[model samples]
Every structure is written in structure tokens, then in C-alpha cells.
Target: MINSNIGWEISKNEFYSENAFSKIFDAVVHRTIINVMAIYKKHIRQIRHFIVCSMGILLLASSCSILPFGEVLFSNSESVSTQPTGTIFYDDFSSTTSGWDRSETDLGGADYMDGSYHILIDEKNTDYFSTLYRNYSDIGLQVDARRIDGPYDNNFGLICRYQDEKNFYAGMISSDGYFGIFKIENGEYKILGHDTMVFSELISAGDTGNRIKLDCYQDFLFLYVNDSLLDVQQDKTFGSGDVGLIAGSFEVSGVHIMFDNFYLTDITQTMNQEKQQ
Candidate 1:
């Protein structure tokens, strides 16, 4: 009976999740729709009672899903993290920018396309960025970045501990192959750590790909590329603040960047343990 109950509940959700899912996510709709239908049909007999309820619940979940396009697309993205538990936020930019916002003057602007978020940079718009509406702390955040145009001399990566327009920590890498960690305080940019050039093999040469990860726990932070740990930093200049996506131009502009698999996993379980004592 329990097994039957679970199956029905699952299929009900499967049915509802795919109904409106194909609308915003036309790219992977055909295959995903067929697969979801198959699962529902396969388990329909066992979980018939839960079908209606599941449909309602699933539709709700779909509307509110971290990545509403579908789990398949979300799972396949390069920046998606496997967190055992605790997630402050996770997005593929597949549905919509839930809490992320930016102005039209923000270079090329941010938009969702083909299961990813795209930013078109040009000479007129050298650098662009978008940030979450709220600040998040002690979280592991990551994203996949690729230049879609121009020279490989540009830089793109994550912005965390962001206090405002003039304050934040940028964990960035250049396409020509260099990485830097910087802290912008009161309009002055300070280099906290940097590698003039390293991990060329880890980053694609031209308009290709690079998976960058940043884990910020307390005062310590770790940065990674291509699934490999590159460097770590410990600082207290900023505690909890907004997270954002950033791009900068060097040699030239019109350097388009596509960011996907934007994931944020927070340390929620330990929010108040020792301090309670």
C-alpha cells in the first residue's frame, strides 16, 4: 500500500510538471515530454488515487521549481552542484530570474536562452553584471562561463559578498588564461590574490567553456575551475551580501558571455549551534 501510494504521488507530479514545462523550455521539450509521459503511464495503474493531487502539487512545484524548465536540463548543466543538503538557491536561468535583477545600462543585459543565461558585451558596454535581490552568506556558489564572441582577453566569473556598486569580491578568470581575486571597497579595487596566468588547460582557448566554483564558508573561501581546486582565501572585509554575475573587457569589447548552471548551496544546518551555547 505504501509503495502504491508513493508511485501514484510521483506520477501525479510527473504529469503536472510537464504540462506547462514545454512552454518556456521549448529547446528540450520533445524528449523530456515523452519521457515524463512514459513515467506517468507506467505508474498510472498503481497510483491512480494520487494522480489529481499529484498533478496539482507538481504544477505548483513546477512554477516554483529552482530550475523550472525540467530536472533533466538542470542536472545536465555544467555548474549544477551535488549538495547533500541545504540549498540557499539554485538556478539554470531556465525559467526566469527569480530574485536576480539588473538595469538596462548593465551592458548587454541578462536573458535566458537555450537552457542558459546570455550576456552580450560590446565596445559601448565593456562590463556587465546582475545580482540577486538578497544577500546570502556561507554558501557554495558556482557557474559555467563561455565567451560567445570577441578576443579571449576578457574576464568573467562570480561576484559574492557584494555590498553595492563599489564593493564586492570578484572571483574571475580571463579567456587568455589568468585568474584573479579582488575586493572592491569604497570605490577602490584591491587585489587580494591572483595568478598572472595559470590553468590554461582547464579553460578553453577561444569561445568555449570554463566551470568555475566558489565555496564561501565563514571567513574562508575556495575557488575551482574544471572541477579542480585553484585557490583559497580567508577574509572578513565582507560577511553576508548579495551574489552576482560579472564580466570585464581588456583588449577589446563585444565579448559575449553565456552563463549556465548557476547554483548556490548554503550552510543552513549549522546556522546556530555553538553560538546557542
Candidate 2:
């Protein structure tokens, strides 16, 4: 539900608990992956041999699924809405030496292309993301993103508090207008706000550009689409980690996305500014 004070409040009672979400996600996703892999093996058995290659290893390890974190690890006694200030990191992807991963494989690729960071996935039920590898905590991240060439049934957005492929928080919106805040803790995926992705009219449909913003401050996570708050939840499994962009294909393969004008700011600075004011 939309809150005047906060964008959207996710009630733990109304949504799937940690164990329940994990069990269901594990069962459903394991079966789906097995089925997809069977089809993959049938069509392209040779791809399995590529795992020894570096790019193959990279993509396989980078692949992530939409998941969630269980029960709150800790609770913040104080809560405050922050106004971002003081840029911490900014990348326009105009240069290839900006420390983003560049890898290409038959499944997909991620690299700096034509002044933007690009990610493409040619495999079903898989996600590939590229991180800046910078450590951070309490960051406000924003980026301009759009599907370049892919199915409308895809997932792409920003990621924060990213410990690794196995642990991170993703604020995601599909091309078809679904949005959710998900996290993977210790290789177990769970959706923080809802049992499944929730549709939002604020998300731009099709290949149109959307300004996606995610605020990872303390235990609170807020996601905004086109400056409209889309999802809000609280979780403290990960306090700090890397930040990056992610794109994933569902049942349909070929999910390609490009991100540009990415910037991250320190939320603590904003909070201090508020206190002074």
C-alpha cells in the first residue's frame, strides 16, 4: 500500500515469511532451472564445454535470480528520509577504463559500448550483472536505463549493498511494468516486499527510458521509478557492499539493456545536512 509518509510499506505478515519464501523459491526455481537446462542441453550441448573458459566462468558466476532475505537482522531505532548530496561515484560509461567488467560469451555479454554500459543475456531464467567493485554503505543510486533489444518480459534495474552474486539487494522493474525489491542472502533469494513482483504504473513500459532510483540507507530500502516511489521495505542482512546494474531473462531469452548516467551519493551527508538545517 502507498503511504503518504513513505512510498510503499511492506508488511511482513502479509507477505511470505523468510522460510516460506525460501522453500517456495527454491522448489519453483530449481525445477525451472532444471527444465531450462534440459532444453539448453538439448539444443546447445556444446555450451556446457565452455565453462572452462574465463568468460563462461564469469557469466555462470554472475547469473542471479530474483530472491529475498529472511527476518530482519537488526532494527533501526531512528528513521529519516534523506536528500542526497555530495556525489560519491559517477560513471557515464564514456571511457572503457572506468573499472566495469568487460566480458563476452555465447550466452551474453557486459561491457562499455557506445558510451553506455551494456548487458545482454541470451539464456533463459538467468541474470547477468556488472558491478563497480567499489565498497559502500548507505548510498543513493540513480541511473537511466532502457531495454535495447529484448523481450518485454525481462528484469533490469539497479543493485546496491551487493556483497556478491549470492548476496545483494536488487531494486528491479520489468519492461512490462512490474516492480519489486529483492535480495539474495547466502545464496537464498527472497523478495522483501511481496511474495512476487508487484506491478506499478509508474514504470515506463516497452523500450522507453526510465529513471530508476534506489536508496539503501541503513535497514530501509526504497525504490523509485521515474521519481515515483515504487517499493519500500526494511532489511539488514547486508550493511554495505558494491553497486551495479543487472538484467535478466525469464522464460524468454535475449534480455538486453543499457545503463547510463549512473551516480551514487552518500545518504549520511544528506542526513547531516538535514540535521544542520
Top candidate on lDDT is 2
What TM-score would each prediction reach against the true structure?
0.62, 0.71
lDDT of the candidates, in the order given: 0.55, 0.65
lDDT of 1 at 210: 84
Off by over 4 Å in 1: 1-86, 195-200, 267-277
* Total clashes in model 1, counting residue pairs 3 or more apart in sequence or in different chains: 3
* lDDT at residue 26 of model 1 (Cα atoms): 17
Worst 10 residues of 1 by lDDT: 47-56
User: Which pairs in model 2 have colliding backbones?
Assistant: 67-189, 67-190, 68-189, 68-190, 68-191
Candidate 1 matches the true fold with a TM-score of: 0.62
lDDT of 2 by residue, 114-143 (tens): 677777777776677777778888988988
Q: Pick the candidate with the highest TM-score.
A: 2
lDDT for position 66 in model 2: 16
Candidate 2's C-alpha lDDT?
Answer: 0.65
